[model samples]
Target chain A: MLPLIHRFIDQAADQNPHHPAFIFQERSLSYGDLVLQANRLANVLIDLGVRPLDRVGIYLTKSMEIPVAIYGILKAGAAYVPIDPSAPLDRVDYMIRDCGITHLVSSPVRKRALHQLLERDTGLKAIVGVDRELLETDPLTCLSWEEVLQADSEDPPVKVTDQDLAYIMYTSGSTGHPKGMMHTHASGASYAHYSAMTYGVGPADRLGNHSHLHFDMSTFEFLTGPSRGATTIIIPNEAMLFPTRLADLVQNEKLTFWYSVPLALIQMLALEDIGNRDWSSLRWILFGGEPFPPKYLRLLMDMLPGARFSNVYGPAEVNQCTYFHVTRESVQGDQPVPLGRVWEGAESRILNGEGQPVRPGEPGELLIRSSTMMQGYWGKPDLTEKSIHIEEPLPGFTKRFYRTGDLVSIDEKGLLAFHGRKDRQVKIRGYRIELDELENIASAFDEVQEAAVVVAEQAGGDKELVAVLLLKEGRNLDSAEARKRFADHLSAYAVPKRIYFPATLPRTSSGKIDRRQLAQEYAETA
Target chain B: MEITKMPDKSQIESEIQTHFQGEGIELERDEDLFSSGQVDSMALMQAVAHLEATYGLKIPPGDLVPENFRTVEVMADYVIQRR
Candidate 1:
């Protein structure tokens, strides 16, 4: 059986107790110290009655405490559900209740928000505040960070198996509510093993953690580093906004492995003169989440002559299934970078509408079969059945394949190139956004009789969400008020940039909302 | 190289509006472009490239903070100061 992810940390700590494990905000924690903290937090979790496979919500920002909470929850034999602390209160409440989360680890700064969320009568039983003083007025049983740290620093000997869930990452769903992707210890361990081997990450490498806890890329950034005994550097949120500052951090931290969405790298390249910076320590630069423009990719290759680049692709449901190494010859073309070959231990197939594998050079949906594939969406059996299909009965065993909904084609060179999405899903800056989700939220408003959302490509090739709302007869809605209402229901990226109240929304012959017509109309008018 | 006059606030706003072309949404001078979902990471990169080419101002990595590009007014101020 595969060992739990925390076992890697334990092994590293035992071997190199004094080696730096993580560096955050100028503070460094050695492997021994980090594991002790995690062990103590695990004892705290056990004392709170957390059992194996139980879901615990992690609602803290990207900080030193995040790694501790994550490893602690894993050590306690419970699956950690990361709730983006910046998410709306209603969304957070929905996830907490949906996942049946019994314990939550958050910072004290969110005390008011947590209290308000708990008022909704979620299944949350205990709240562990990291660095906030517990008050009598707190709605739930709150434990201070100091108290949790005082627990015995011994590993909790919970009977955790490889099949046990390690984490549940929630992503945007087409049906308005976010769906939690369930990943097991086996799947996560496979990813860690393959990733460490593919990227050549080792103890000498300093891996940069740029992605948020809620994002799938963070799995590779956080877990693979520990798996290889590498030092993980958590880039502060504020540093991300300033490309120059982020570059300085990379230089100062001596990051050897850097991974993030292509958008962030593009921003850094545009704002910073990386050609002049000391990037000798930067070895592997990995990007995914969206397609990178060829021009920018070429420029990036030219700028970083010493670094090797890889275009990694996969959904949250399957972590890092395929990777395309950017070669000097590959970057010469005007075409977008190829999705490349499937990663080791993962199977891929391009099937047409009839579910048969398509011929080479024919566009079809990509299906993935791998140990790293998510077990299923949490409490969403119907969605799970629809998204994952079991192959027809074979002699030995049936194979389950996940329909990725991504349209791709294998070129003559045997490289898979992305065409487009087969569904209404769109990615904006590495965030998987479902257009119907925005439409559903808009339709929920009282004044909105009908709503349609479309992705509009700006002059700079950036996709922006545009909403067309048809109000009920004799009723009106203010755009500002609508935007304010959207903030309460969705994340900032999900909010449409422009809201239009048209007299009637165009429909197709089948009476479905015609998004193409709406897009053309909006474009013509603008 | 000859020094040229820096663009005004309205000109920069006009250029940004033309670049983004948000159908009918009017951007305020002090509006937070990022939080408002108007300026994403890619859009910000495009805006930086456009500003450099249009205004002939070298926007170093240090000048790419929120304070410099949070709004057209601030962006124009940054350009004028650099010029």
Candidate 2:
């Protein structure tokens, strides 16, 4: 049993030396090559003073070098902080200083971004995997990939326990500050083991990784896929924007398991003529981060009868706790596929505002205590303590349950159903309403492709709900009829006061609907 | 009678460069604009607005994919063909 996350790759390399661990474009990195190359990188990092539990930043695009940098940092007994190469230099500097990342692993392809970062006073010590041209500052050192690979292929002399910090994932906070979520080797390994066991992943499975390196979903490919010695085919960034190209990649790679947000799969279904393509190679489709529009999901289910769909439900704080297997029959209706029971090694509770359990079938905040949960928000003790509820059920042992901030309830079938977010609830003219509820009801209309509900500030600093909708091509809506339709399901105060049509809805980097952007747009226009 | 000159690829490239210049970003002719995280949906919208206003070509929702605007070169070619 591999209790250490880094040991997963070692065991895989021992079992399947020739097996491909990661494939990008036409290049492939075999399991043996991954271990050997990672060893060299570990030695270079150790030489560069990357101590145990120290944070090392990985600043590179979606490429083969990612897995190598990840395992290498782990082997050095250091936590790898994956910095988005495309992020602005200011954010990069903040993360580097926030986590005390003195060293970064990157490639020459990012020299332009690296050069700008070096121009700033970031207090960085050394940069690896790039040329000396990146060493703009006097104190900064650079080691090219050639120089790093010149080191001996031997494991670093490091012993890491399961409780050691393995990685720190930074998420944009609502307050405009970024919070890093620290995960230990125990949490990472537990999630990888539980997910692999639940999904019955084996060496025969070929996982298609669609999530960005900074996104939480990348864990399946980096940790879970390697634990079972399965191959991961990385869909490059170029392929993601083009659905037709993505369809070609799925067929050419023969990926057995596909995982991403619903928006990605929705694009492939809508833009690309995927009806002519064969999706027979796929066995599982896992979607999370946001709810899938049920209308498009129904079409995808019909198109890919060979695949089984699972609605993965969890916050970035917990990685993932529950997976609801979707069926062709379930998506036939407009209702979303329910969030299924919690997977093994996880426990959940539905609690109300007073920290008491809600009555069965009543909406409440979903709280989860799992081995797959994060340690806490990095360096934000107050925020960390606020997000979790500690219960000393036993004499000394305490169980921590993370408050998901999401509202949910158990159905008659004992399956969890998601409601709108608690923070998304707002009071308009002293009437409290959930914006997500209004958006959901409006989007359920056949002519509506997508809809977003936002709160716009009024002339006298009052707030009103505004609905920005994207209608299907050639579809028109009568505002009076639409408002009447909304009135059928929602209260008069809860209904949006105005509706605006847009050519397209703006999406964030991870492809979630940008509600904050919509709210600001309407606020300014109003 | 004033005759409007047909917009060429270089002219379109300059327009794209000027669009990014307003945002303080140095536009690369061949680098991926979208995946590089430099051009987000909002940023791409500005470029689309420029293309429509300058080239007088409507970019339908179907043709608004990244394949047509992956880079400055790609977006220029798209404008030339559409114009």
Candidate 3:
């Protein structure tokens, strides 16, 4: 049988039964306990009428239960779909209805949101890890964590191959609705294998999980960390909001591996007093999703001299494909490090808009044909077709490449140099934001007649979103209401920081909202 | 908004209420405001500025932990403890 994704954790449990599998708030779940809990939960899911290949939603904040839910779903031969616990109810409902997720594994921490979600007409058959009281309101099944912990620990009977679906991660699309990127066991296993081998993580390694459960960055900590018998330390969401607290977590956890977005490190550098901290245990640091600004990258390197750093690169469509290790000699002053070469098990091609190969050093879209590539966007075949390019190099043999949408070039050092996105999708705080999605959200509001969003370069060199709205006559929205509205639809980091009410927005000759002109105006004002 | 002393718990609570009032955010006292998108970084910093301005206490960034700033009651408690 091909190596299944959850088999990694199962094998680890067999080898290192007493080793810490996951850690939170100083509490450790041994591999033995983790396996049992996952088995029990898998049995509970199976009892809840979950069939093989069914999608289970994980609506949770960062917690130890996340790993349990993930492993349990995979053990039951089901695809786990992680939904952002903080997402708007409509968006959450959209994912559930769109993907036909019948069972959701969530913690009590999401009780408030889950209650609100229950009020919506979601066709969920069961919500695991919730209070029994919810049954009074919703007739569907609600199993408490106590039951999952106490249920039968015998492994459930299942037959799953690597080709079976494993998970679907949803991200904002340029279109109004969010899109789920589907990954099978084969893809997830490939990613875990490549990242674990690339970083050389092992049984003794302690991994700091800095990303949210829904974000693709968590793949490493969730899969690779346990696959290698490393103990994963989940960083609480509360700590993430406070940079000093996050620095405290890194020190207290003594995590050997730290993988997160560059924004996290930059915030710590800006807000924390690193001189007095004991973050000496960290040996490897990987940052991805967005470019790591050189000035802050240099500062982080100087501070964490004992740790090796890598600028991890790739889109969620294809799991992390490249890593640029940082050394004093590799990165010059304010010169960004190259994206490095693609790792084993993955190949890439740089093609221009005309779908032809670009010159060696010319910039073009990065297309990746990797074992880690997602199957496609869930329920959106047209979108999947649009996002990927296929070639028939050999008769009766076809090759598929996911278009990264990231513009890159081969630098003088023969490494990939990343330019910005090929489209209006700009990243803020490592979260992808399709500018048009923000506009669509604003336009949907009753007050907004038209809206436009622009990424403004702030004085400190950070990017801030500035939104201009042409409101309906006599209707107005202040920053607070706009914030609530936008935050209700998008992630916290994706909310536009600045709002402007113009009597009328600029327009092009074709009567389109001239975002270019608005962007220019904001740039001038900044 | 100048005061000679740290405000009482009620006063601190009222100030926090006023800060988030314009944003139309209503939450349980102990609910997680930060992660739920109810409180953005800009809003959090503004609340920090509001508390500092009203109570005349410089909140060191380290004190911005959830215990002190996640909810109105905790924020009030933190401010009340400052005296």
Candidate 4:
């Protein structure tokens, strides 16, 4: 059987050879052209001694090179590691060394960074930069993107078993190190196939590539788009943060499909001139990086009367496990929006803290079992075991299930509804937050004598972390000064929503600040 | 407090209603904005900015949270509440 991603690209090239497969800034690559380029890239990799199962890191931003690099890696029968360029420098070094990556195909800018980093750790085989001149001099030295594509071979990679790893993606590490989750060809294919069917992707669809490749939401855009012969348009970087640019692309390119976190959708809805933008071309909007506000759902429906909005539920470990179809009737009713039905080849259930299945309407942890389940964290076997567990006395218990950590419930209709996270890990604008990280920063503040961070529920059921601090004996700092200090050490989102100066922290008899009590106070005052 | 009708009150109420129409409960001019739990801090930002731009008014950055946007009525009052 053909590998899942290749099967789609091959079919698309054969059926619609002249159709535009990818549209970057001033360049448009047709299905046939993309195939040829990927084939040449595969030939270059083979000549450089890259073999089946060898991991190749693609370190770059969202660009034309990303798609070519993905296709080339798979074409060489090698799995790819999509390194986020914007991640902290230490993270980039850790992923390269941890994955045992041999070659990194990246842009010239990244090549420079790699050069500086690899000098400190020279075990890397090569730093392949995207320049024609760079590729000619050395099989072991840095090669350019053009040099790799100059080969004439049209042959595809040799077939491999379904269980062979396809890609390795790293997510936020709870244990002080980023964890790389490995996915096999078949499992990763499951995500591409299910997304195509679920989102109704086809030749006529124009899909927007919005999410960074590091994020799972971009999988469908980069993987399924080419396989389905749909046109995948990469939104320019500056356009990502602004809604006007997205509106322009949708109306200009006639983009029919969109996938991003709900926060992006809300930003689009808040546009004062949103009414002027013609988003009629958008047919499907699949969103879920975090729990979306139901209010944003209604605003979207009112704005785009024809778009089919869906709530996608899944963690990075399992690509996409469930979806809730957005309907007007559901919005009018009092019930919360469902995360929808389980996608193809997936099974899901809500389990209580004790691991037993919860009764319908009872909140519990959401668990997923599916073909798309990751192999495991790249190196941390202990964490892998804890996250992927087996239920005793159950057959196929060895088959792993991923714990999503999200508290949820199942309705009578079997639709999943999100409640909250069981841990202090809150999603701030789609980026995962470990409250402990904030606490670490708060404790580091020189002026702060003591601190506690708690998620407070605000109006419309949204949660925000507010930091309550007790100053040192004689020193007092205002909220502005404390926030500035937090910004220096953490990302802006990690900074608490509000900083409160309390005369004395409310503590339990044991002397631990009563965080629960603080939350109650915020709820009352908020 | 009862709100006096302002030129921007109708525009603010209309936008808030449209902004929050399908998400959940509808909004009235005198509804508790967000601090009192009528809307949310996250969703309220959208409503605040909508009113500011639609009417050419600016809500200070220091006054960003729900305390400032507690009600469509308070917001309407804020049109005059500003220093």
Candidate 5:
């Protein structure tokens, strides 16, 4: 019964009506104005047959429309499924179908791609774009975002309970096919409250939106910022790849808070003659999504001497349950930055392979229990039961906890430090990757008989993907041709950096490819 | 393109070598720096900063990919061309 996000919007509308909630490109929306627009859109959805518990997929980018769609969905008593506009068509299509989406809210420019996906999958019943042209275009019942907001904003708000489904997020699908992780109103609100309180986010703060809505980290910037009447600035997708441009945006926008992957900070620190910008306003810099290199900590502390840094750690299943405060003392120490203690209302444990609790300093699977934990994997009861569990054996605690596939260690001070993924999952630039997804696609290539893709840490600690294949005996495929084939199926990130046409890949007696041997062989050679 | 006296290729290569300290890249001017694992993205930035500070030229953002930073010779030529 928390109604966290909604309560903030309503409060802002009444208390800080003129304060900016979002500042995009050249436009800004006051708190009252944003809530009013969201209310209008909610009325539109209700008019279009949306009901309690129905799913509405946001097929948009990190634009102003995103928050509007989110609040509108909530106001209509429906759950939201946010699909990253930049995600591969297959990933988006898979998520929409998996969530049983009946409506999609996308941008006008993104309509063609959404149409292509909808053509193959009949689950998406309506595709609404974000403008007047989209509204005018009557091609098979399409409506623009403006058309939807044309409804009266004064309609009595629908009754929504805290126990109701608020959103269904797809895990980056690092282990396999993306599974929908369901959440309730209370769970989503818990994180929004915790993030704002921890960072002291308020109207004076301006948060950066570089992450896609699909990633759980976006929950902190996109939700908490706007909810507090603060300005949330969207970092252009292309600008993120170019450090200078990203720096310019941050400087021009005067961003006060930024949360992104460690890889991005590495890129920023690498820029040539990267002049110290007027970052005096930057109060906090949060990094997560994977283990950050010690080098990053050294560089950032040297560069931004004044800003406070914190390393956030958690899985998408339970968004941001722990944070390690990065003070001047921790920076001067020899140890790698710890992921730190559990956040409020969160508990964690390190368990051995047999599900027994491990001693301190020993690496084991990390388990977490929190209010923000996902309701369950949507439409998969067996999966829900397998992934989430009740206490079977523990000396002191008897409660349910979510079993994270990540390997971690608990320090003597009870701080949790992440080691690596226990499963075949790997994180590249904060994006969870399922190696099986790459292998399954690579196996589909015409000239490949068997493809085993292994990731290796090169010198100075850079992870590179190397594919070792046992091709058809007489067939020879050059690296260029093999890479081209891989590009056709997988995204640029999933493509292996180097392709090795080995005579035969080493296999264990159990008839499984020995990844350890491949890594060792490639580590020295790559 | 702004032109400055091209420093001895050997001197530029020496600077690149010193910056890469323990990194395993041959100190040849013509050898591919990126593909041979001699310089990674971070090392490339270090090299770029050195060239910018020493040679008085600003490297554009678009030209900062691995292809352009392939070799000491290529980087020197690019700096000369862009200057």
Candidate 6:
């Protein structure tokens, strides 16, 4: 068993030193060059006092250097915490402080952002800018990217076991705080090994990676691509936003495997005229993160007749447990695509409120047991216990299951159909959002006495977040200003589409905010 | 079918509104549909499909830039040019 994911790249480098490992922005890095750069960075990390299981932050935009930084952290026996460079400085500061991160790897353009974060007393010790430019007037301790690359091209001697942590990915928590999901090397490796096999990835395949590094799905490109000795093409951020450009990239890069949120596919299909383009090189198209609009899925199928589509379903906590391959028979009916069966080495159970297994054709909360399951939420034992449960031995086995909080029904054919979420968690354009987090951020505003956020369904069946705010007596609030304030703390997707200043908020019998009532009223009026 | 003349701005706006089923309000000719949240990615796709079918215009991938679809006036101009 591989103790760390970097070893896979090491083996690949040894086998095919001249093969292209990463293709980004029209530049290619061979396996040998990648490994040597990673090794040099690892030595630099060791010299910078990164120890076993220590958390290092990677706060850079999408580029070839991202893989180098991730593998370097892994080789140094430290888990990499990926922070979106575009995220608000306050949010970045919170993550750095929350995870006790002392060292950060970033690009030169983000030096000012790092300085702003350091001004908040985040205790960030050192910065490793991935560019050669030196900040002469910077107050924080910083190292140039060239200095790290100049270090010895020898792997650092770090004792990392399978049980050691690999990464800590942060997601929105129900209580408005960001929670880190901890994954050990074993868990990550399990996901990488299984997903690669499932996709039939090989050295000849060029995988398309469009997801940001902060997202969990990017792990497929970061870990699985190297493990399978395949090439990864990092889709530029601009291409990700513009679907037509992304489609052009698919043809230009000759990507064999593509994985991203369904929204990207839908956008590409909508914005791009691929009817005349030659997409013969494309083979597999896998999508998840949110439900794909069935109508658009059919259109996408029509566009890419040669590609095989798979609807993958899994939360960040459980990696990927179930997948349904899109077939003519599956897409023929009025029903949306069913989330197929569990992948190898993973088991799923649907249980009712009483923890009793739901019979076939019944709906219940989905629970997952898998080797790829996250270790736990970092530093939150209460939340960890609430999410994961350990059951007593049944016959000869003790089972540990993670509650998915998603309501699903397994049909008589053993195909799982997603019903809806069982909680306030919602997905907006592929990002998992907790409504409570948005409400908490809204209420934090000085002019707002209370806040409630609800998802409103439009005529087209797309859900939009609407925020209802109650102002304090004698306080004035501007909606645009409030939105700008909210943008400072939350992601742009989490910002409410419409803001309403209600005279008084509706309440439930127990005096809690009545979200359902608010949603209904808003829908009726707006 | 050949279109003898470019559609009026109001005609284009009404068609867009009908396509979106009146989800937005107080639409301006130059208002940005995306930034104003009048249309999301899904709605944008639906609008594009609707335009292609209704007007018999094939929008090439390169013309899908935001400048061409940012406003009703720009979209109408794009449709006229394509026609």
Query: What tens-digit string does per-residue lDDT give for candidate 2 at B1-83?
Result: 12188766777687688766544355688877754554433345557877887778898867877779888999999988886
User: Where is the poorest 10-residue window by lDDT in model 3 chain A?
Assistant: A517-526
The numbered model that scores best in DockQ is 3
Worst 10 residues of 4 chain A by lDDT: A131-140
Give chain A TM for each model in order: 0.97, 0.82, 0.96, 0.86, 0.91, 0.96
1 or 4, greater by lDDT: 1
**How well is each residue in A1-526 modelled by candidate 4, as lDDT tens digits?**
4365655677899998999888976788888888888888777777777899899998876577778788888888889999866443456777888889887778764543454555556356765555645343333466676677668657664776778888999875644456789988888887887878877799999998988787777888888887678999987654564465666777888889988888777877776677888889999988887766677788888888888988888888898899888888878755567888877779776789888999988999988889878988888888788887676557654656788888988878888878988876777778667776677668777888888888887775667778998888898798867765654433334457688998999989998999889998886343
lDDT values for all models? 0.82, 0.81, 0.84, 0.74, 0.74, 0.82
> In candidate 2, which residue ranges exceed 4 Å CA deviation?
A424-526, B1-8, B21-25, B32-50, B60-70
Better of 1 and 4 by DockQ: 1
Clashes counted in candidate 3 amount to 0
Regions of candidate 6 where Cα sits further than 4 Å from its true position:
A130-139, A394-397, A524-526, B1-83
DockQ in order: 0.09, 0.25, 0.38, 0.02, 0.03, 0.06
Q: Please, what's the RMSD in Å of model 1?
A: 6.2
* Candidate 3 lDDT by residue in tens digits, A1-526: 4378777778998998999999988688999999999999999999889888999998877777888999999999899999976566778889999999989998776776777777888888798998788555656888999988889998899998888899999999877778899999999988998998999999999999988878899999998888788999988767777888888888888889998888888888887467788888999999888878787888888888889999888888888888888878776766677888888878889999898989878999999999999999998999899988899999989999999888999866668998878888998878888998898988999999888999987766677898999989988788768877887777556778778898988889999988878877776343
TM-score of each: 0.87, 0.82, 0.93, 0.77, 0.82, 0.86
Name the docking class for model 3: acceptable
Q: Candidate 6 DockQ score? A: 0.06
Give the per-residue Cα lDDT of candidate 4 at A243: 60
lDDT winner between 2 and 4, please give it. Answer: 2
Off by over 4 Å in 1: A130-135, A524-526, B1-83
* Residue pairs of candidate 5 with colliding backbone atoms: B2-B83
For model 5, the stretches where C-alpha displacement exceeds 4 angstroms are A130-139, A174-176, A392-398, A444-448, A458-460, A472-490, A524-526, B1-83
Q: List the residue pairs that clash in candidate 6.
A: none
